[model samples]
Target: MAKEKIVLAYSGGLDTSVILKWLKETYDAEIIAFTADIGQKDELDGLEEKALATGASKIYIDDLRAEFAKDFINPMFQAAALYEGQYLLGTSIARPLIAKRMVEIARAEGATAIAHGATGKGNDQVRFELTAAALAPEISVIAPWRLEEFREQFPGRAEMIAYAEKHNIPVTASAAKPYSTDRNLLHISFESGMLEDPWFDPSATSNKDMFVLSVDPEDAPDQAEYIELEFAAGDCVAINGTQLSPLEVMETLNELGGKHGIGRVDMVENRFVGMKSRGVYETPGGTILFTAHRKMESLTMDRDVMHLRDSLISKYASLVYNGFWFAPERLAIQALVSESQKNVSGTVRLKLYKGNVIGAGVKSPVSLYNPDIATMEADPTKAYDQGDATGFIRLNALRLKVGSGVEQNAKK
Candidate 1:
């Protein structure tokens, strides 16, 4: 009989490197390591060699940056999905794509089981498992963090480090630096370690060096910079007059936004796992795109349609954050969001200063903003008659007038 094959989502990080070796030893199965390159810059360096040396029979390092931006990030931005009105769902959005690819690789390699390094107490476990459940119901998911034997063997990072040392598995984790970070094309998120304390100030001098994507707001350039964004069907198509692909757009905006110290957010968010987690995120490019897209919609999108979409913003955001990216309800909401963006094509000029994205101007070919009627000065078109206000107000006030008359009669 052939040995069982297990495909593991490998990041070449401490947790995953250890998990790769542990899975090989514990299950006595052939381990196939998979790494998704969704724009983690230097983190992908020498990953293949490390995985092979760490006992992976095979490794897949695929570049999914463009797909990540176009398929996942673009649609979410169209819905203006913001979890709890703050989190951009950076880490939350990346997991489904990672898991989706993992399932694809498992099918190609004929693997019977898939594995991930997400902790039991975190939302990642739910994301990975749920994606697997939805995409490939036949394949089994192995979560080591939830197993008693695995937890007992390595209860803390110290034991995992020692095990790595004993097995000669190279890892970057150390006792001194304890926080965890997840990075992708959309954003980079920092959590755990000292960030677990809700009151811990991430902007303090001691934590200044921890930020990877943007500079501190106070240290930004003294001058503000202006940039224009072009949108097509609610997605950003160009920046500062240069046409860019989805991937290029993200890369360029990250550089620009980072220089201006934009897209730094610190908030305590409720995780899908029923726990409150404090996270600091740097989403420079995403912030710029979101602001520009919103401004564009304001110029082109109808008020009622925008309001109806806004009504579902919370639901849509919750669906994405809760790992239902592939679920039916999310798909239904996405259909409506896509329909709403048909007229949301325009250009928006913005001023980037320090950490603020201030709108300078917005215009669209199909803009509904009729200056003739909206202008305060005398309207030469006479599009809106001033005499119409009397009947309009009287009709609107009739209910209030009737209620007041009833009250007066009762008093009398």
Candidate 2:
């Protein structure tokens, strides 16, 4: 009799490694491990051997770093995507791309099912499942965390540790830290365990050890570094005088920003599963990009257009966080986003210093900022319409003025 094969989205993490061995034992499936190298630096180290040691028949490590930066990160950067108005959606944006690739591999390998380490309660499950549904709905999903046997057999990380010990499966993780973290070049996020406390200040002495990509602000370089970003339709194409690919741009910014301790954010954000989760994120490239893009928008994008997009920004972030990447709604919004970016071409200078990214300057060939129209010392008669603003203000204030008079009259 032949064994059924399942493609697992493996990360060589404790959860996935344990799940890999457990699947081979329980389902008798030839487990094929798949890891996506989405800018996690050295995260893929020794993963192949580790998977094979833990009972995976084979391993696939797909280098999706370029694709992630170009397709996912760049588009989201154009949108200036921030989930819950603070988070840059670093981890949120990476999952869909990886899952798409996983499904593609599943089809190529003739796997009966796709498995993942994502727990039933997290956004990752939604991310993986949605991508699979959108790309390959026929393939079955085997989530060990949701499985009755797996959950019952190992109720927590302790049980999984014991199981790994019993099987002599080599694992480096222990139960010392109850938290979980996810990282990529753009950002590193720390959550779970101690972070579950809403009142906990993540920057406190007890918690200062949480960050990964940065040094302490006090220890950051005293001097500020300024870099100019060139954007073509809201996509960063160059830094200073050097042209860059999407991945090149991020890595450069990450290196520059990390050196200055630039991108560190900690906040309790609304999760897609109707919960407020506290996550500390360090998105150095994203910090510089957002600062530069917003500055450039002042010189290029229309005020009305910027406001319209701003109004829908939260909705866009929510959709991305909730795994609606393939929905028509996201497509409709993204089309408008693309249209808005048509003239978002410019150069923005940013000053990075000790976790602060400030806009130094902005220049654009298509700048809406005309000195002739806006200069304070301009001749009082030409290139402007001050008299027209009287009527514009009157009409705009009609409702407010009338409401105020009505209240006064009633009081009188």
Candidate 3:
């Protein structure tokens, strides 16, 4: 029988490093470390060498940044998805992309099982596993953080550090401030460690160090910067006058918004795993993308269609937040959302200053903004009718009038 090859999603972090070593020892298996680059920037630094040194037989560092932003991020932006009306789904959206690549690696490497470092209590476990199950159900999933043997052997970060030191695996994680962060072009998310406490004032110097994407709002440029974003069928296609790919748009906007302190959100969000977690996220690009997209929608989208879409927006947002990216229901919702955005092609001008994203102006070739119909000072001419509204209003209010008439008759 062949030794079971397990493709572990390794991050070169203490938890993943420990998982890699533990998998080799306990399962007596050949472990292939898999790392997905979804715009995590320097997080993928030296990951291959680190994985190999940490006892993995091989490593696959997958760069899915372009695909992530184009396929995943842009679609979510179209819905203006805000999980529970707060979280921007920066971390949540990245999880499925990473997991999708992990399953692909498992197939290519002929690995029987895949693994991750997500704890049992978090939403990421559900996100990663649901994706794997939806994509490749034949493969086995090994979640060591939830396993009894792994938990007893190496309980926490201290044990993982000691194990790394003993095994000669180099790591930057120490006992001091082990705040876990996930970064991408759109945002940087900080959680765990000192941030675990709900009441922990983020203003404290201790927690202040957790930020990576934005500068202080007060220190932001005194002048607000106005820029125009062009969208075609819900995806941002250009910035100012330059056309760019979806990925490039996100990267460009992130840099512009971050410098101006445009997207910083701190809130206690409910996890899909039936728990609440406190998280601080700086979603610079996403902030700009959503603001601009809505402005464009207002100019081009039909009023009735907009109202219908808005009614289902919360359900769509919840699905993405709860890790249903691959689910059929999400696909159905996305289809309708996409149809509504057919005329959402346009340019939206926005002003960015501090943490606020203010809308300036919006225009579209398919714009529904009829100046002649809406202008207050102009006559609508022979094409319009005012006397028709009297009957229209009376007919619509028939239910209320009939109820009142019946009450008066009964009293008499």
Candidate 4:
């Protein structure tokens, strides 16, 4: 009989490297390592070679950059979903896409089981398993962190390093920087180690090297930069009058936003697993997109429609943050969000300066703003009729007046 095959979500990182070897040894299974390219830049370099050397029988690297941006990141942006009003849902949003692809690879490779390197304590384990269960219920998920045998073999990073050395596995991890980081196209997040403390000041002199995607706001250039974003039906189509694909748009904005220090957030967020975690994130491009998208909506969207959508922001945000991206409710809510964006086409000009994304102007062909009705100048020919004010005000105030009269009668 052929050996049972297991597909592993491989990042070519220290933990996953160790897990790859451990899975082969523990299960005596054929390990197929898979890596998803979601705009990690140089991190993808030498990934396949490393996975192979680490005992993967086969390696698969899929570039899901465009699909990730168009399918996952774009919809989340359209909903204006932000976890805890600060986190851009960078790491949170990427997990579902990775899990989806992992399932696809598992099916294609005829694998009976899939595995991930997410720790038992973190939210990624929930994100990965929930997506897998929702997508492919038949396949087994191997979570090494939750297993007693796995934990006993390698208790910590030091032990994992020792095991890697013993097995001739190439690893770049060290104990010096205790923090771990996750990066993709939208943002890069840092947590664990020194970032575990809720009160840890990332801006302190000792932690100056924590940031990766952006420069320090204080170190940013003194001169401000202005750019215009063109949106069509709630999607950004161009930046500064230059047409670009969704991925290119994000990459371009990241360059500009990072140069100006436009996005840097540090907060303690409530995790779905009933834990509070502190994280530092640099979401340069996403910050620009979120700000400019809202500016465009302000010019084109209806007041009540925007308010109703605003009420669902927290719920939608929770769905994404809690690994419910593949859930039915998220799809239903996304339909409503898509409809709300029918008139969200417009252009917004913004000024970027020292961590500030300031809106300069917004315009749209279907704009609801009527300048004639808003002007202060007195004109008899205009739509404004001053004589109608008294009746309008009286009609609106009738209920208040009636309530006041009722109170006065009761007092008497």
Q: List all candidate RMSDs to the true structure.
A: 1.7, 1.9, 2.0, 2.0
* Cα lDDT, model 3, residue 363: 85
lDDT of 2 by residue, 96-210 (tens): 8888888888889888789999887788889888878888989999988888988899888888898888887877878787577899867999889988887777777676677
Write the residue-wise lDDT of candidate 4 on 1-412 in tens digits: 8999999999998899999999999899999999999989899999988999989999989999998888998899999998888989999899999999999989998999999998887889999999999999999999999999999988878899898889999988786776888999999999888888877899876776888888888888899999999999999999989998899889999999999988999999998888888899999999999999998998899999899889999999999988999899999999999999999998999999999999999999999887877778866457888889999999999999999999999998
Looking at model 4, residue 264 earns an lDDT score of: 94
lDDT-wise, the better of 3 and 4 is 4
Clashing pairs in 3: none
Steric clash count of candidate 4? 0
The sequence of per-residue lDDT tens digits that candidate 1 reaches over residues 220-258 is 999999999999988889988999999999999999999
| Candidate lDDT values, in order | 0.93, 0.86, 0.86, 0.92
Q: lDDT at 284 for candidate 4?
A: 98
Model 1: how far is 189 from its true place, Å? 0.9
What's the CA error at residue 396 for candidate 3, in Å? 2.6
TM-score of each: 0.96, 0.95, 0.95, 0.94
Q: Which is the better candidate, 1 or 2, if ranked by TM-score?
A: 1
**Global lDDT of model 2:** 0.86
Task: TM-score winner between 1 and 4, please give it.
Answer: 1
Candidate 1 lowest-lDDT run of ten: 170-179
For model 1, the superposed segments whose C-alpha errors exceed 4 Å read 398-412
lDDT of 4: 0.92
Q: After superposition, which runs of candidate 4 have C-alpha atoms over 4 Å from their true positions? A: 379-412
